[model samples]
Target: MTMTTDMTNSTAPVKPGTLFGIPVGELGWFASLLMGTAVGFAAFFAATFVGIISIMAINTIGHHAIDYSLAYKRIGLPIGLLVIAVAYAYLATLWTKRILRKA
Candidate 1:
């Protein structure tokens, strides 16, 4: 037995738009870039903050156990910030898509 599917009937149509003379398909790329920039900025700041704290703790405390604890503490903030930024970017993308759907 042979089965056939209608490939020609399975494709959806594309919508068109222009932003400052750029095509709508390019908007998805633009949105991705913007999200990446935001996340990168968040990570940069988080890492800077964590690094400064870790340095100060190591200089002042100067104990092996305390150093390990401080290291973990210093890492915690950046990890949390990265998680939040990723979630925010995901939601932002969904929101953008929803808004675009209505247009």
Candidate 2:
């Protein structure tokens, strides 16, 4: 029986004009940074909105009011939004890599 190696360079070929090993196609770092940041902020706001709605719904079900002031003061929403934003930024950067790769 013939044995085959798993770590072969038989992967798909890479296109030209890639930055950071990502096929961004001559995209500058500054632009990509801004794009990533925008994506992060978008995710942050979207997640925050959904979280707030969910919190309000849950609190209402228990006959409790949503304490907006306490929520912000406790940094719950802020922390969660920050984490989601960072994750989105990372995904956006990864998506950018795929953008030019397909072109």
Candidate 3:
């Protein structure tokens, strides 16, 4: 029986230049930072909108059961907002990585 040992490493070292067809590297870091900040701002705006809607709903529906439901809805807002934030962050990271690969 002949045994073959795995000797080849498939992972390639990151080169400083174009990566995945986009120009990046150090510049990519700055771009990613900017993108993250922009996404954060957008998330904040969305959260604010949701908050306003929740407040209006609470004001309009003054029943006890409705108020309890509103509280539950408000609790969901933060989770939804967090999901959005994480998705945005992931997208930004992916974009940055692609750009870096190209650069």
Q: Highest TM-score: give the candidate number.
A: 2
Evaluate model 1: give its lDDT. Answer: 0.59
Model 3 vs. true fold: TM: 0.41
What TM-score number comes out for model 2?
Answer: 0.47
lDDT of 2 by residue, 3-23 (tens): 987886676666664545765
In model 1, pairs of residues that clash are: none
Instruction: Residues 12-88, candidate 1: write the lDDT tens digits.
Output: 45555433454433345456566556666676666657766776777778853344444345665666567657745
- Model 3 regions more than 4 Å off: 1-27, 63-103
lDDT of 2: 0.62
CA lDDT of each prediction against the hidden true structure: 0.59, 0.62, 0.59
With candidate 3 superimposed using the best TM-score fit, by how many Å does residue 26's alpha carbon deviate from the native? 11
Q: List runs of model 1 lying over 4 Å from the truth.
A: 1-27, 63-103
Mark the 10 consecutive residues where model 1 has the least summed lDDT. 17-26
Q: Higher lDDT: candidate 1 or 2?
A: 2
